[model samples]
Target: AGGQYRLFHRADLIDLLHWAARRAGVRVLLLQKVREVVPGPEPLVRLASGAELCADLVVGADGLHSVLRQALNGDEEPFFTGQVAWRAVIDNPTERRDDVTLHMAPHRHLVTYPLRQGRQLNIVAVQERAAWVGEDWRQQDDPEALRAAFADFAPDVRALLDRIETVHLWGLFRHRIAPVWHREGVALLGDALHPTLPFLAQGANMALEDGWVLAEALGRAEAIEPGLAEYRARREARVARVVRAASGNARKYHLAFPPLRWAARTGLRMAGRVAPGMMLRSFDWLYGVDVTEGSAARSRK
Candidate 1:
């Protein structure tokens, strides 16, 4: 089990969190859409229904189009990264849940992995295009369009695509990591702080880390300002590094030049065969981190 990567289905994970949070006596509210957030000594959250809530501190875990992030930083648009992706889940007859696989070609790539105890396979197909697509991932796209994008892919990949009857499409867009993470009673969390490309598969993980580090920082601080500042200091460098690394991944998969692509693949294959441990160890600083220990130590005098 050492040096292994684990994957979880998003919906299933959310359900688990709901159960855990409620078990811990945390009230879980749904369907109350937020209208705006006002940050100061005491933060205020105004819901669209005109219901208002006050908190000693407001944390924006609202994700990419976060209303709170906009509240703090004002309006700024995230530029399209010239890429779009479609996500779908299909029945996995083969029970291929053990590992993720990637199929790459010029300007496009298909990433597939098993989910839900290998009863289903999750597919994410991405391609480079100049056209602007909406940032919404819930926007449905024709299944045929999905097939056409990877028509020339390996037959196994094509067959998996054939099983996708429903797919949602979204444009990949990046916003600069918010210039500020916390202001008085408010702090940004997760994608609200930084929107990362899917390449590193660390977007959700980063958010989880944010929660751990932020909470630990606050627990050890004398005041909210110092705690929030420490949380940002601990997180910003690691997050920026992650975002930069992920941004470079599209180039690796979408290599347009045949020779360049071959060389890259060849080098990877060689690394896999010769020094696989070293290659994986390169990510040790990332995957090996124990935020509990790090945050506790850093929070100490």
Candidate 2:
């Protein structure tokens, strides 16, 4: 893509947000585990410490396994996508790459990008497998397993993998958009509403857009119900499109047949040489969007 793409450490991003929230007088209560959410005229949240607090609106920004989602809608199952991903971050003091690099192979692909002022590299390797693994992202796997999985990759990639001391393995599972996004005064945001595959790298982007649109709708609406209704109505379709695109990219990257993979790679190389900007322009709908102005205006209308 021709547009500017920046990478940063997840911890650094979270720290920046934490400081910004505190500066804005947003009181963030840490370690307050929510046990139950009771939706009604007065939405009640029960904490693990036996404390019950009532709020006007509750936004669920939790990850893939969300408790509030189960309260708003019943429990639903997530289907495994027959793929697993190994993630690791290694020191890259001498490496400086501003752009993401993807090395693709049969039934597998490895993406690497630098972060933290080019002092660290983040690697995400995905492989198609028949066996199932739990979906927890924090589950650790031996570094040797990750290296063995990509033993046939390029020498440069193998050199990078050799530096990995620890890795996390997680199964890629597909979770559909919740049938109901909001009930009473409780609403879902981010992965709680839609958990996307990592192919398009739109999971965080979608969540940020959702927060923006939801805040805009609620701020302008006369009542809570109308605000939440407008939020879901405006977001649901666009998110569904992005999710479908991500899923398509997953299939395109993981073609196992030799001839098919060769053809696809050749076509991509030809496209890059002939019309480099064409590939970037195709993502205008995604990257070119200005949610604050465009989406907010659409919601008002």
Candidate 3:
């Protein structure tokens, strides 16, 4: 609540994670895709390249499409939420703005924020549609198509959309949190366990929390099984709350009734005027969470 929001490029965040892992004597393996994870008496990882590896404990941090998740909780499909999002990063010719700007309209919203020390601008534009394209994040869309979607936006927004040379569009889908977070010696961390919508921008943050809490819990537990159980117990409730909050945020942003939307906006403006930090303070339960609330020594382990 006291600190400012800092955005990170996906690559830089991963680099930092890898750096910390390596510093802690972790052997970081690259380009090795996990084909399957068998969770039982002996945890196993089968690589796509036909190599099998065994470990004491296997933590799956893989994103939306996780094979490990299927192994633990069966093949559950995610249904589209009738929303499609396009994301692109463009060079920041003007590095003056370093905050998130939201352009909200009925059934659609666009979010822009600076990244990479304001050298790059990150754009997220979401639109509600009847049909979903697909949930694959790597699916590319023509810049012209993106432009067409937001052609009616203000000139400044339109101009920024015009600057996009490349963009990826993905359908927003709702995934049920894996009923079982872990099985045997394999634990699902991050999106593998819970995939929240981008509405709150907490997908990565929650995953980071998941990793830290999982590690901290395991380090404190006497046995691997108990550690994993504790990890799941501590995270499931919190993640569910976040998932609901994110969905609710989408509803608030996509309000269709003109009067309702106007009232909501006016109320927010009045609240900001009356209690300057009221909006953010209301989210203290979220941003103020310290998952590592126990022994630091256990965390170091």
Worst 10 residues of 1 by lDDT: 290-299
- Prediction RMSDs, each to the true structure: 2.1, 2.4, 1.9
CA-lDDT, candidates in order? 0.90, 0.90, 0.89
Off by over 4 Å in 1: 294-301
Model 1 agreement with the true structure over 214-298: per-residue lDDT tens digits: 9888988999999999999999999999999899997899999999999989978888899877678778877777777765676
Off by over 4 Å in 3: 293-301
lDDT of 2 by residue, 64-97 (tens): 8888888877888899999999999999844576
Q: Whole-model lDDT for model 3 versus the true structure? A: 0.89
Name the weakest run of 10 consecutive residues (lDDT summed) in model 3: 290-299
TM-score each candidate.
0.96, 0.95, 0.95
The alpha-carbon lDDT assigned to residue 186 of candidate 1 equals: 95
lDDT by residue (14-56, candidate 3, tens digit) is 8998898999999978999999999888999999999999999
